[model samples]
Target chain A: MTPLDCVEGKGLACVRGGRTVFRDVGFRLARGEALVVEGPNGSGKTSLLRLVAGLLPAASGTLWVSGGDIVIEEREERGKLIGWLGHHDAVKPQLTAAELLRFFARLQGTRAQSVTAALERVGLSCAADLPCQYLSAGQKKRLALARLKLCGRPLWLLDEPLAALDADGKSLLLTMMREHLATGGLALVATHDPIDLEAARLQLA
Target chain B: MSAFAALLARDIRLAARAGGSAMLALGFFAAVVTLLPLGIGSEARLLASIAAGVLWIAAVLANLLTLDRLFQADYEDGSLDLFALSPLSLEGIAGAKIMAHWLTTGLPLTILSPLLAVLLHLPAAAYPALLVSLLTGTPAISAIGAVATALTVTVRRGGLLLPLIVLPLLTPVVIFGAGTVLASIDGLQNGGIWFLAAFAGVTLPLSPFVAAAALRLNLSE
Candidate 1:
């Protein structure tokens, strides 16, 4: 696992669908630091996080993670450093919650024990055996949270992490985010809603 | 279990759960083979003559119908991005998907084709050649078809567009596959089987990389 000391991008710019989303955006984040990206809809908050995650290549500029430059197919960077939570729920409706977590654990090259631990942590033990199709929207978001915690990556790129979450679900995520920061993990969360935590804010116009 | 094994197993299990693609392809293949007698003349000599081409064409189209399901489901459910994040390379994931696709569709078709050959009035002498040709040819079709399947994964109605792209690329496999059986009936040396094997050999390794590259393009878009 990479010990995250700092992630800083220089002059970041994003282009999508032949239009520039954001240009000349730059920042540096270190261990135990959080950056909450706030912006209006279509203002490139999600695009910014995706660019850092290497999902969307930056139109220009460099994103450096722990002193290593971001590359699209770098397995070590993607597998160990980045844990992404995009808008679309990645869980398969056909697989049971436990089965899905186990599959993800295997994909992350981690132990299956983390799957059970994360499920319990997220209060999903009761619904563990049920297929994801039966999961309500809130329960499905919790499942995605369980997967993020279970994977154990050092950097999180969360896009709208609180959408569809209940009060309990929101608190659970805040705790996870806190624990992640305390343990030297870095986070860049994009949302238009208020996050009641002490975080460095980057607002995109 | 290894990541590749898990992915391959999961894909096959999912296809089995989907419940229609593999079974539908089989039903379609059987119907085409069965209807051939009515469409053409019922003469035994004529049926025997065209049996090779007819059976090969049916199997190809039947297999083609399921190709769209290969990557679209993963792409839609957002697992494809998670797959890109895994320790396994995209190429490895593509290979696992294609293997699962072959196991469910191509492998079954190859096994069932010889049985359908009897309905087509295929001579007993041509049976072994038919089996060998399909065994070599099916993997090539799966591997090559996967490339086009991955390309159209982002398009909404790409399933309908699959045949347009795939049929032209896989025409050689069909030609070589049918040629192997025809050469067997004519009491001539069939070098076509060697060409069929070589096509499988070349495609099985190379196509996954091409498919993976296309999927990455789709993911970023």
Candidate 2:
């Protein structure tokens, strides 16, 4: 059940702030599989994620997602297929857990669910009604993960998904990843710590 | 259709939850209009003479109040990144945001213009033209503000810089917006409304592209 079976890159290079970040760097993640990108700060882990997500241009390379050209030319289509969570939590602090999920779901053209379903999936049902600004760090991360349950995109590009998670939260995310892969979904995660995934590892030095 | 609607809905919901900045903007517009008569002589004739100009200036200022939050909140929360990665073109997203901004800021201002106009003693006949011009022109202000919002997304003190970046570009909106009211007051049916409508037509389609490009650059940086 290869959800994403095609290669998606080309001798890609990126230069940032007048310095070369990485060159000829590339990898692929298919359904039931994952790619864990480990790197130190400023080593282009996030940049590579952005590049794959089509948020940033490669200084010099090509990207193909599921065999489709990765030119960001069709953003709405790409958005439906890929879910990207960057270093910063993108949740609007003023919105409640339920409101945030509904907002993203609507943007993705998916039907809005009871915020309870999303919050419960992420174990935040108790805090669903609280504004994001009031949530604890780990709780905020959980709310963001709830988006995955509601969004149902094929590819997940997570930058530091484990950043502020407690041990329990981290384990919950690992379980979620396994579930995602079991369903033939693909993931590309950039993290500083090693992630427990039965998938290939790409180290950026 | 759904995508645009979703974007608009999400933004409006967020704005509403955050305290209804639209009403605040309108209140600010009203306040600004009220204060002018105090600073300048309160003579009815003098107020009537500059009524259109004062309303237009207040409208622009009111719109600027929410401009900094347009992309900054999304950028901070990472929704901007998701938006950047979504299959929707950045241009479309920018356009959706501009529309949302107009709904939240411009629409309220337009509605309140009559009340402010009465306060300013604008000629009775000028009210319709003034309201119509505002309806057409404020969208242009929101669109132009998108570019400035994108440019200043990564800046530390974007709130202060927003006006600096947007005021110059907003000059056209001010000119045409104020010009139409003046024409209406003078009983001279001029082309100000046409010029304003055309300005919105051009900027509505084009400014989003500029904003999208700028967002791409800022996010890349």
Candidate 3:
């Protein structure tokens, strides 16, 4: 795994449905940093994160990630650096929670042990055998968190992550993010609520 | 397991679970083949004459029954976005999905065709040809459906349009598949099976790239 140290973008712009969502956006986020993206609905907060995650191609400009002497700009290479948590939890209703995590663990090339560990860390050990359809919204969000943690990527792109999370679940997520940052990982979280972390802020208008 | 294997296993497991698409397609295939003869009034020669065409059409329709949601479910549940971010390439994703679809739909339909053929009084001599033709031809159905499904994945209620887009493209597979079976019954020296195999061969390798391109376009939107 490449130890990603910094994510840099220059003159980034996004267009969807023939309308410009954001233009000339630029930022540099080093390891151990978090950038909370603040914006109103329809302001392209999700699009910006998606762009950085290599899910959405930027309408204009270049974005790259670097670790020491390794500078990466290709979309596939950049994708390897990101762990995404979108609004949808990405769970199949028929598969049990454990089964779901196991599949993602394999996809991400994470060890089998991480699946069990991540489930426990996310406090879903008991619900591991339950199909995702039976999981509550909070439980499902936590499952997504478990998957995010399992991927072991250096960068995270989270959109509305705190939605459907309980007070404890929210705190669990915050702690997970804190641990992720403390371990030289980077995060770009899009949220309307204030996050209790020492981090940079990017406000999208 | 590799990402491709994991995805294939997950999809197959999902299809084995309750409300799975595989069972739906299989049931639909069996139901239509069973009901059509009742409507057509099974005079032996008439039934045998049309059996190849009818079963081939039923299998195609059965295969189409599940195609619209093949990628849409993953796309809707955010799995597609995560899939995009994963180590697997989009082409690999498309291929894995196509394989899972075939295992669940095409292969099963092939297995069930003989049993359904009895209902239509399919000539005993044509059984092997029916099996061979379907086995070779249905992968192309899955392959082409993947491209069409990927193209329409983001359109709400795209299922209504899937057949319109896919059935026309599948005509060659149907014609060639049924032609091979019919020729075998008539003991004709025709090369329809070769043509059917050739169509599948071309489609199997090419659809993944096309589907991947369509998926990339849709995901970026």
Q: Give DockQ per model, in order.
A: 0.56, 0.61, 0.86
lDDT, candidate 3, A72-181, per-residue tens: 87788778788999999998889999999999889878887877788999899999999889999899999999999888889999999999999999999999999999
For candidate 1, write residues A60-110 as lDDT tens digits: 988777634434345435545788888888888878899889988887888
Look at candidate 3 and give me any clashing residue pairs.
none
Q: TM-score per candidate, in order?
A: 0.93, 0.92, 0.98
Write down the DockQ of candidate 3.
0.86
Which should have the higher DockQ, number 1 or number 3? 3
The positional error of residue B87 in candidate 2, measured at the CA in angstroms, is 3.4
Best by DockQ: 3
How well is each residue in B98-207 modelled by candidate 1, as lDDT tens digits? 99888988888888988998888899889888888888898898899899999999999998999999998898899999998998987665699998898899999999
Ranking 2 against 3 by lDDT, winner: 3
* Ten-residue region with minimum lDDT total, candidate 3 chain A: A108-117
Best by TM-score: 3
Off by over 4 Å in 3: none
**How does each model score on lDDT?**
0.86, 0.83, 0.92
Candidate 3 per-residue lDDT, tens place, B1-221, comes to 39999999998998878899999999999999889878989798999999999999999999989998999999999999888888899999999999999999999999999999998999899999999999999999999999999999999998999999999999999989999999999777489999989999999999999999999999988
